[model samples]
Target: MDKVLLKYAEYNEPHESCTNTDIVDILNKKHSAMKPAASGSSEDTEMMGD
Candidate 1:
């Protein structure tokens, strides 16, 4: 998702358009319907120092 936004901003010219908060809100709404990953996986445990 971050990559997508970076690429969009990189290729597109800057203008008086959406702000950072606007982009965050848009991404949040777009992804909010998706299910999150499961907890307690090995990667997650390692990241949490558990």
Candidate 2:
């Protein structure tokens, strides 16, 4: 889930010493933490490293 966390960080930078659980908690609180990429989207490959 590093990709997800990294993407999340782009929108909101977390504490320097935060752990993975901390990052997930931050996302959980937001509710809309992530959404699936659109079809035929190049961004999906670029950002997701597909």
Candidate 3:
């Protein structure tokens, strides 16, 4: 999905001192802190049994 394969960074021009690796590390930390939601639960489970 987008979460795994997607990645990018944003920063103010004044903060240009930040390196690519630093930005990626920060992003990784922020993302890892989030808990993954249950997959494929949005649809009707009853339909799958039919």
Candidate 4:
């Protein structure tokens, strides 16, 4: 994330101007679209027959 921002900064692009809320919104959207790991919790472990 820092590297991406740095590149944007070097290029004088507006992409690097995003605030914390913007980054959190992006991350939250991405996280919601992905499944949790198999070993993520006791419930998941039971479901996996672990």
Highest TM-score, which number? Answer: 4
TM-score of each: 0.35, 0.31, 0.38, 0.40
Q: Which stretches of candidate 4 lie over 4 Å from their true place?
A: 1-15, 36-50
* Residue 33, candidate 3: alpha-carbon lDDT: 65
Taking the tens digit of each residue's C-alpha lDDT, what string does model 4 give over 1-50? 99876775656544556899999999998787654642366677687894
| lDDT (Cα, tens digit) per residue for candidate 1, span 11-31 | 566667889999999899767
Best of the two (1, 2) by TM-score: 1
Write one digit per residue (lDDT tens) for candidate 3, span 1-50: 66654444343434446889999999998777652432344345656877
> Per-model C-alpha lDDT, please?
0.72, 0.68, 0.61, 0.71
| Clash count, predicted structure 2 | 0
Most accurate candidate by lDDT: 1
Give the poorly placed runs of model 1, Cα more than 4 Å off: 1-16, 36-50
RMSD, each candidate, Å? 11.6, 15.5, 12.3, 7.2
lDDT of 2 by residue, 1-50 (tens): 99877775755555678889999998886655343334347676787885
Candidate no. 2 TM-score: 0.31
Q: Relative to the unseen true structure, what is the C-alpha lDDT of residue 10 in candidate 2, on a scale of 0 to 100?
A: 57
At residue 12, candidate 4 shows an lDDT of: 50
